[model samples]
Target: MDEDLMRALREDRGVKATALAKALGLSRVGIYEAVKRGEIQATRIGRRIVIPAHVARRLLGIEMEAA
Candidate 1:
């Protein structure tokens, strides 16, 4: 996976699952499963689900950005 794409996904608060899947060369179902299994963190936002950038970096074993 491209580190830039990973970083982008990990820094963009509003990055969607579909976009992440495309960027990571992963299926959307795979991303969903990861969320379901708590391998990644996500929260419901109205009718949409969102994953935090910090959580994404953590899941990738990368250092989180400074808040």
Candidate 2:
């Protein structure tokens, strides 16, 4: 993972699908595909879909802090 993306994930509470797709160099449809395949987890907040920071970190192989 790049430093900028790591920093963004670390600082943000959650990431939107578009931002996540950009970070991963994927299209929005790719993100949707991942969600369908259960490769990434997402939650819908009204019309917006949000991916938790911890989940993104895990997908990037970043160690998460113990809760």
Q: Tell me, what's the RMSD of every candidate?
A: 3.7, 3.3
Instruction: State the lDDT of candidate 2 residue by residue for 1-67, as single tens digits.
Output: 5565566677857777777787778998999888878888998889787788888777656775543
Top of the candidates by lDDT: 2
Tens digit per residue, CA lDDT, model 1, 1-67:
6565565655676556666676667898998898889876888788665777666656555674565
Q: Which predicted model would earn the best TM-score?
A: 2
**Overall lDDT per candidate, in order of appearance:** 0.69, 0.76
Candidate 2: residue 38 Cα off by (Å): 1.7
Model 2: worst 10 consecutive residues (lDDT sum): 58-67
